[model samples]
Target: MFTRLGVGVFIWVAASAAVADPVLQQPIDCTLGETCEIQQFMDHDPEQGEQDFACGAASYDGHKGTDFRINVPDMDKGVAVLAAADGVVAGLRDAMTDRRVVLAEDQTAVAGKECGNGVVLRHGDGWETQYCHMKLGSLVVTKGQKVTAGQKLGEVGLSGKTQFPHLHLSVRKDGVPVDPFAPDRDGQTCAYDAQHTLWAKAFAKGFIYQPGKVIDIGLADRGPDLADVVDGRWSDFVADPNAPLVVYGLAVNGLAGDQMQLVLTGPDGEVVNVTQDRLGKRQAQWFAFAGKRPPQGGWTAGDYDLTVRVLRDGKLLHERKSQVQLTR
Candidate 1:
């Protein structure tokens, strides 16, 4: 989940503290993709908590929506994003950034970087889906409108803070982020080839790992626990009036698949297991990565780097590397 899982409960309570709204029902079609497990799928990596992947596309930061990369011919062709179910679109933040980083808003700053265009949709149980950094004018849905699953919501493009055209989708519960990698982060390790070893299969599962959680890293402690803090920055999660914005200003490609195997490594090569969580959203499918809860000692201080790769036919299409710091 976004922020930290330990604090998610509190944050959820706080998000609902001021506003009182009903949780949207399952608005999307749950039977769109294979729901099979495919790890190292960059496009549709999600957290299912060991359950079959709800969909292929994966969201790294529990941004809250299920995504599929459209890993077919023409990675471009302006990918078409669809609605997961029927629900009213909410959180419309329409503004252009001032600074010029990439295609992102000229004014916004992300971890010292800039961002692009994005959107957000609210659902039940604090669940919300977001799509980010799309083409300038490709959205098909309008504000305050209701949509059904697989509904053409918009076309993917390289708009806000994007190097290439992609969609950054996420899901949030009660305004709290849920791990797209279901089950646990270190549950499965993706293998490049049946012959190539080194716990590679986890990558194919496309599940969310727990180590990615902000809480597991002990971000709140004022103590010198985590070390080698690199690539650290924070941003506010606001619903874009123009489009759905992924947290930290990211882009989406498409959904990964049904189920995914996850494999992760922490500081000093310590292994972490995780899974993906797929659940229907008020508008679309949302995913998160789950894994064995961090140790009770509150984790250990260390420098960690995670290399996540998504592949097909033993070919690496997409991959992500995350830096982490923790100390207890």
Candidate 2:
């Protein structure tokens, strides 16, 4: 159901008659913090500066869309990108090869293929949305077709002007790009209005922006797949007493001068491994791990603990704990 309202040349579909807001669903099929991460948001700043939906520095310069990213190792595993609302396919591009392009080294080759594989959707009331960076051959919908909210559009990919695997979603109203988080990126009104928001009331809660967050953490026998680190294979799972053990975590929204500490404790209350350091510059995401071989007589058959801490200026910012079991 959609309610139409017109204001000059611009218009929007109200999620409900009583609300008068154009509600949108999450444009992906995976759970946040489980299979994906909100890498970057639309630049709330109008002059190509930096700001996010929450008025934070999570976005980069001139970033015009919301970036939902997946781990690089999982890019080939086929994660589906979905439509945010019911709409007709405006157009699409899919012939580009699904390959990584390092922008700093070769900018010329990626001139016309900045968006790589993309699908454009035209909703009622002059609203439009574009999903970019799809896998080369994974586009499932064609031009002029109708798609319901949550319908699969394509798989996320590393194609185009991207250093990571992600889906870049651009939202527009009457041809002008609008920030979905709020009406104006600048000024005194930080409150969200229904007329200015394009997300479902329920979906809006999932987007509470955090400047620094530990997305995932776990223990592993080997290192870890760059894509799928917490494979659920080590959590409470039995491990060989003598096998080398590793504790790792992935973080997002890191700033310059942030410090990180990782510690792994054995069954006998002994510190097996530790890592401490300060990060440099701004970063969208970072990963770290610590590991060591078992003692000469092998680890005791008991529970082990791993803890991760992220701090800035001596203040605790984030902390996460993971565990594993060992057997003789």
Candidate 3:
């Protein structure tokens, strides 16, 4: 596992070139409510990978980095750039025609991964991190400063030859960029890092994220805006026993036989019912299903647990849960 050890502490030492823990890998920041316009993908989203059209050649003669945008719908001013791991900062480049810098070195490195602002910090396990395109002087974390996971190395800004403000975070295992979506080396940076990553660009300056309220989470400018309809969702559960609680949303993720499942269980240690619905494979859809449709004998109404799972190849990639109070 990848743990951001403090300075001077090398926990996992490699014989020659040890690989960092895949599970500890930190992804580019794409948190809830933050919009990330992903110009590329790793191994996980292959279809998306195919759709990703490269505008120009790779690195333009050894520039050593890909370009991306944070065209998140509803965001206009963009978000802040941040560091993915802890390490000694190096490779600070500036004054180029496009105006970009690179901090290359961190423990989490999977192939096909793109971490902007490229801040590489050397640590134990022969690993390093890369944060790309900071806002000129926004990088508060200086070289030689030991940083922890989620530490604000700098704020995301449209600097360093980038069109938007999103961290193009990547990792170097044994001195090479690694994919951020590979499962074999998943979590190569943070042992306790399970939350999904997000990167958003500016859409509209006035829109603010209200947490509980549903927000448009999609990269509209990049073609196919998969809102809750054309997309899928992560939402609260409705436990109104009066009717089979309805769950619906939209998203452009998951494969066939992968519908949203709602797991309902009462206070007692008993499994009442496992709700499963096929989301199908489409850009977007308005989905709505009753947890317990008032069928023949009528559905029982009571407090229960609801777990929404997105399944594919008999695996749950995404899932969410909420409590509901059912009624007769």
Candidate 4:
């Protein structure tokens, strides 16, 4: 069962924690769900309780790295995968082509080639990082080449043994796989061990460990996809007065019994529609939208605001807002 709450005032609370690690910088230009997000984290506790570098179940059994992901459509458009730290290129692979395999079962050709197009870097001391699932033919560095932090290495892609587009970053110490979240280089961290996390304190703190997240938002004549979001497909809207006024959005990490609410407001401050419904069983990712054909004679001109919210057990979980303008 789901309940719809009236449009209330927006409030935000800030929680800050100091970072403990200062060696590595974020290797990508996008933030969580902005241009990219940590799709998966290394699985430290694989036998029973699965935990990510953040000590969350965002990861599954035996996952060996952190997956920084952009939507498939965005990967096709091109998003750079940068070096997280200064290091010398140790190894690389670029033979695999970049193509969406829609399903994990269909990735046999690149089976053992899990890291389809990848690069391994050797930093000072015993630290080594491997960047995986890069776009074919997009490699910008060569073996043995020294690179600085933030240097572009390649683009994220859906090559190898992945069903989506992402860069799998694997960190190792003395050739042993290590969870970056574990400063002690042991294994994994449970939720209660947040203080021992090794992530750049600032970058780690900003990421919300919630189960549901609103990834992208847009206004389109039709439903938009990951590719559409990357291309700025719905950035502009013309008031056809006779056409459909649609606002679409994408979400991930959804669970059963979740509720969604979408509120659309017109330029004249009139409420267009408020779509609310309960979601089905568990879904790793979901796309939800709301729209309707314009009223007779045409539509109103001016600014429009779209607000989306996800709720569980009557508690607000996630909220996103996007503004679009209607023209004459």
Q: Which candidate achieves the best lDDT against the true structure?
A: 2
All candidates: CA RMSD in angstroms? 19.6, 6.1, 14.5, 10.1
- Ranked by lDDT from best down, the candidates are 2, 4, 3, 1
Candidate 3 Cα outliers beyond 4 Å, as residue runs = 1-30, 37-39, 43-78, 94-118, 160-164, 183-328
Off by over 4 Å in 2: 1-21, 103-106, 184-186, 189-196, 220-240, 270-275
| Ranking of predictions according to TM-score | 2, 4, 3, 1
Tens-digit per-residue lDDT, 159-263, candidate 3:
443433445554456664444322233323322112321211121122221111112221111122233322222222233333443443232333345555445
Instruction: Please report the candidate that would top TM-score against the real structure.
Output: 2
Candidate 1 clash total? 163
lDDT of each: 0.35, 0.71, 0.38, 0.68
Model 4 per-residue lDDT at 140 = 95
Cα TM-score per model: 0.36, 0.81, 0.38, 0.80
Clashing pairs in model 2, backbone N/Cα/C closer than 3 A: none
lDDT of 3 at 311: 54
Q: How many residue pairs clash in each candidate?
A: 163, 0, 84, 4
Error of 4 at 67 (Å): 2.1
Instruction: Please estimate how well model 4 matches the true structure, expressed as its whole-model Cα lDDT.
Output: 0.68
